[model samples]
Target: MKVQAGELLQKINYPSDLKQLKEEDLKQLSQELRQYIIDIVSVNGGHFGASLGVVELTVALHYVLNTPYDQLVWDVGHQAYGHKILTGRRDVFDTNRLFGGISGFPKRSESEYDTFGVGHSSTSISAALGMAVASHYKGETDRQHVAVIGDGSMTAGLAFEALNHAGIENSNLLVILNDNNMAIDPNVGALKEYLTDISTSKHYNRFRDDIAKVLAKISEIGPDAYKLAQKFEKSIKGTLLKRSNFFEALKFRYFGPIDGHDVEHLARVLKDLRDIPGPKLLHCITVKGKGYSLAEKDQTKWHAPGLFDKITGEIKKTVYEKPQPPKYQDVFGHTIIELAEVNPKIMGITPAMPSGSSLNMMMKAMPNRAFDVGIAEQHAVTFSAGLATQGMLPFCNIYSSFMQRAYDQVIHDVAIQNLNVVFCLDRAGIAGADGATHHGAYDLAYMRCIPNMTVSAPMNEEELRNLMYTAQQDNMGPFVIRYPRGNGVMVDWQRPMKAIPVGKGRKVCDGEDVAILSIGTIGNEVVKALNELNAEGYSPAHYDMRFVKPIDEDLLHEVFGKFKKVITVEDGCIQGGMGSAVLEFMADNNYRAQVVRLGIPDTVVEHGEQPELWAECGYNAKSIAQQVRLIGLTRSMQTIAS
Candidate 1:
């Protein structure tokens, strides 16, 4: 179905077209742009509330700036849907986040208007500062560089690092702090409190309004009053506001706490700021899900409510006939609570991903025990280590991709010290629609390499529970349990938990011709493959290697002694992953085997559904079955040759 854009939006094919509109028309343009985003996303299914929240600001930035020449970078580019639409991508907007289509986040290759490619949080300030510095070096003095970053992203140390450096550069950089108080969930930390204080200050607001009137009158009076107005403004900022303002200490000229939804005023302010020199910050206070009533009420739930009814505000869901298995995240959420209930030592920690990682359940059930450390992945890891030093078993739940940010902390604070910290890496494989940056593709390889790290992944919810139970036990140093996003194989998942021995694996079935070894939830795919192969009278042995590190040597020995042809499968990268681990074990023990490794290959996998990605990566059930058949065919041909 072709969703028609509004009359104003239809005319705005590019920022150039947007520039042709009257100043008053921008409000209508914002409304149309917001509706267009709603129309496309309601059917197409991508991030929802974030793009909705930044509609007015998106319009204002493009309206004031000479985009493409004047660089603009979006922090955590999920919120750039409006930016994308305005920057000549409105026609193909329906293809957002689909496989082989446009990306969910901004990409440098995709458009010249996208000054910097971004997927992760808190990168905008640094990127925009770099652009600004380059422009300064090249003598492009008129060029403007802007970074639109969320308050949630502001909590990260990287943002502060950029701000600290940007202050000294004397570059034309504008850091627009989009203070919607959200990053998937509500913003937390001292920064959140500080921003709240500034935005809600009655004294500051009154003084700002009074000063604005005086400045307006002074500007009309003449050049001398304008000079006095500038000095007066600086004096007021230094005397009354600077003591309380955090950004001022960092040497940034903080300019706002203004209504971001006001399109005309925002445009005017942005136009004014463009002429001002050095590092400046405009703190525009906006709503996370502005214009949408239901989204405004429950921002988190509507953050990415896939395929919703824009009219009725009803989020769509896949209707299954029978009882379906719970998502791996929900299983973790419930299972952690179960473990924490009995074990007093167990505590939970996540960096700005309470809901995403499902630690919100633990946060609700055991409020004091679970902590949301804002957008500081490094802090979350080290903080978990700190808790571990005091004998508190901390399950530091983080997305596998996001864990890359805390690699140093994981090794230095936890692994090197041999702290008993249980690292539950959620979204532990091809992370679907959010694309490559979000994919949990490297944790298997990364975690296994760390000294004293017990790296493991579960095949199903029951195994996950068992793994969690096992990790919490005494003397288990720096345990790492990773699991994929979405549903596990088992329907009845909440079975009583029991500890399985570490470095152990189990034989799912015994066979004669060939052997198939797998690790983690990818083993479930191997099961499906076996079923298909069996129907066709092909018998292949299967072993589920639960732990990647301290791999089951006994199981490997059993397989090598029986079969010459073997296949290793994992949901992670083949390089340094479970398949590589198995091959290492085989070579170490001096066992010769014809091994065919199947997993994520050495390439960038784009956004798609889980099943589509698995097939594309050649490790799905169908792919596995085909591999087994091909191997069986080759063996028969070799036997005939002999």
Candidate 2:
């Protein structure tokens, strides 16, 4: 349990245990905690940097506040590792983000101290505000509400809305803006610049504190004099920094621009602010990957670096060095830049995921054309639509799961108006370890239902490139190009870009007994299943149904008519996914064939390795093969019955 020679973290079973330690020992505890996280994540592989950056803040907050009863909500839960460790999950910290183990993010189901389950960014303020308001209504004045959010997350409209509401309500709430100048990648937009100005302005913070001291003395003199001094302070704040006045206008008592690394300072600030009335804001300045030098230098790369040597800071090489395939995002990154070179009208946009979606590549190459619009999803879509209206072709890159936030923009701005905005949805399937909130399971269903929207999912990197290429050719309404996370199965994926016919599919392998149809990168798994089935003397016809919208009726007619036994496999939900499309096709044509549908069932998937999750959903290579073999068993049973 103990990490250091003296063993500080080993004794911390909960927040109370952490509180029992000497104030001086807290600094050592923070160091031990950081090392422990690095040691565990070096082997296990989880989100880095954010957790490391918040170690001091986490230790200080737990030490200052009466946690479980007080209510501490972490925005997105990326920085909750230290919180998890100190609050009785240290022994199980090694199981982070693994199947049937503790999650990488904070979970209400996992622990009582979690307070609220969060995955998406910018929800912490809103959630914590609600908790604060609830405590007020219940007459529980002792219960404190704290929302720890990142500077990048603050760019979202949701965070502002929460802050706005909290301000008007005048409730007891403390919002700690973890200003690390980065999210998953480096922070962007005017808000980031505004915060940076505040961070660097030492004279302003010092002068402001001096004014506060004079105001405190003015309060003792007389009530009227104190009010006059407060009014003067507001006028000076308005004149000095417009951004500082912005928070003050919202009725929040703004504090800090303080060193987040100092445990003693943070604890002191937090204890003083605990009694302060109304909505409070603490702007704690910290470096992303604070303790780790390599990570601090290249914060984006180390955001979620896979397995690595803790001491050497080098990525551990695999024993078996196979030919490395480019990650799906890398393909998008390079392809977007390539396409932008040809088309002057083409513009790239990402909602706070410059690095994650690989839009950073384009951003770096053509700074003017590509943009990281911060954590504003709805704004990003509408902004892209605005660009399309001005005769510019906008490629809006958003994670498939995250696109749910901007659904209205897709319907109203793009599809309804018939704009030529291209939606490049990365992480279009299981999304492996991050769990159900991150799964791209609903894009197929949601996108297909929309009118004038061409919903397409690529089977491989080649198709992805071609599809992206085709979407940018003309003002062909709105097009959605979705591919999965991680590397494509193909190694040599830099194929020439070609225009794929909209809503058309091609046969991959020929068969007779049963037909296997698939969509997305999941089709690669189907190919594996078919090859395995072939080895066992079972041949099934396989079609890569690229577009989910048009359903490829010409191909479906041939598939359903040729084979009585048909199976549809997809990486999304079965309710309204590719399987549903096939069923609809059969109903319209009245094709009375025994069709088997395979995909994610009507249940939430747990966080696990992709293969295990795919198997759990009954769509992995082996699972698909088993489903195909069922055709023979079913046919035999029917023959015997007849």
Candidate 3:
């Protein structure tokens, strides 16, 4: 459908307008919103299934709650597109997740109603709890705090930890468990099963509803009769639902496994619970992809749908002129398969990111050797360590940002023990659109400090393959090979993978007056900068420092002897990252050379295109060359004056 001309949705400039509409119009509004999201996503690829699933919930929440006052915290924030469209962002919906456009997740700076910024999962509950605690401290008891968390997010320990604390504190908060029964793929664990059992238990809701009706009928018998009914209802509920009352045990008043698609029912439930005392959890059962038939059939494919033909619901296929090597993740995934094939001791693991990490291929190839540990990052680390102790070469693949969750494990379990495990840190630097929380900036800082840990980064796919091979063969201690997100430089993979000399940096270009040292994927950009410098009759020596922990002191001394001025470029924090390592190395060795550090500043970088962010942070080719030229010019002028 060609979205109905001048539909009510087109006129919905803001969510306040949504609240003004009659309850009966909500069904039409949901359809329009779904169609709107579908249209936008079909044109500009984005997270589709998630936004589609929560249309009704989004509608209900806006209708029932006094938003921008009654705080709504979306856990992962990927599913908040509907919420965004309704809340004064309908026009900008087409620009979702693009460079310099509206962010895919909830951004506090973008809207007053977006109470907290979120990209990572399981943060909503903690944030909402904090807001509630702040409200209590301020003596503002009138305002309500709500956290809308998905089932996938619920598996995370942080969410549970928040729930445990919230229950004990007895703060007035609402935790809406959006149980879609999927998290990219099917959710795994005891809690997931328990939730499914609760939702499907026909007897539980039927008995509760029957008892409630019976109690209502007895209200004419006076106040004493009402008291008796309350007592009777509690007794029946306790007996009938005798399974693990996890929420109640946490001191939360558990409500239901209600129909999440039913907007009126959801609204009514929220309204009723609006006045209820203490912490409450309303479990709303929803489908991952509700309206779109193709998405409903294969939710994963539509989870983050690409640009597609809207009419056919078919994704637009890109014809490659030349076939390219697989993504870095794919290379890692396949390399692991090959390694596992040779050595049964080699195992694969990911923290609910099989697809993202490309470990799904390994899992398919070697079922027994690979494991998906759900959304538990910390657990994944420790578990990998446990496997390491058994002489298994566990390759723990996790996104760089998520590895923050398991920092302690990286130090205590793997690093301290000198376990022979490989940490394939994917999306290691300047992860473009995901923003600050998702950026893999601090990994080098944190990982470098850990003893017995060898941290290295590859410049391209071939180097990545070689690095993995090197890490696998080296049985000394824990090793990490960090790689960036998206496609690596399309290189000839026909040549067999080779073992790189550990802790070594190589020269990419040679010059006299100035030298530029770069690490990881930024090497390519640095080379481009060098070419530009060459065009201006300024040739700067360039070095790709493959390893971060081992400072490549030999290369540093070589560069220092060759040039009086040096600059380090990295796609990480300048604070304790690659720049700091280089500076510390120069200082420790007593090598006197003027050094300029170029990397992300000690501040949060917002969501945008990777190249745009690089340009903004002075990492792009033009910016780097310009900075180098200016630095060279200053030195030349000073020399002339001297």
Among all candidates shown, the one with the greatest lDDT: 1
Residue 259, model 1: Cα distance from true site in angstroms: 0.9
State the lDDT of candidate 1 residue by residue for 347-410, as single tens digits: 9999999999899999999999999999999999999999999999999999999999999999
lDDT of 3 at 613: 89
Tell me the TM-score of each prediction against the true structure.
0.97, 0.95, 0.94
State how far residue 599 of model 3 sits from its true place (Å).
1.5
Task: Give per-residue CA lDDT, model 2, range 1-642, as digits (tens).
Answer: 433313888889899998898888889999999999998889889899999999999999999999899999999988999999999899888889999899888888889999988888999999999999999999998889999999999999999999889988767799999999998978888888888888787667766555645553564677578567767877776666746556777888776678899998778777767755678888899989999999999998899898999899998766646787889999999999999999999999999899899999998999999998999999999999999989999999999999998999899989999999999998888998999778888899999999999999898889999999999988688999988888887899998999999999999989987999999889999988978889988888999999998779999999978899888899998999888989998999999898888888889887998898999888999998998878877766887999
Model 2 segments more than 4 A misplaced: 1-6, 208-229, 232-244, 319-322, 637-642
Q: Give the Cα error of residue 124 in candidate 3, in Å.
A: 1.5
Candidate 3, residues 216-296, lDDT tens digits: the string is: 356467657766765676676678775857787787867777888988777766777776656888888898879999998
The predicted structure with the larger TM-score, 1 or 3, is 1
By TM-score, highest first, what's the ranking? Answer: 1, 2, 3
Error of 1 at 641 (Å): 3.7
The prediction achieving the highest TM-score against the true structure is 1
In model 3, the number of clashes is 0
User: How many residue pairs clash per model?
Assistant: 0, 0, 0
Off by over 4 Å in 3: 1-6, 208-242, 634-642
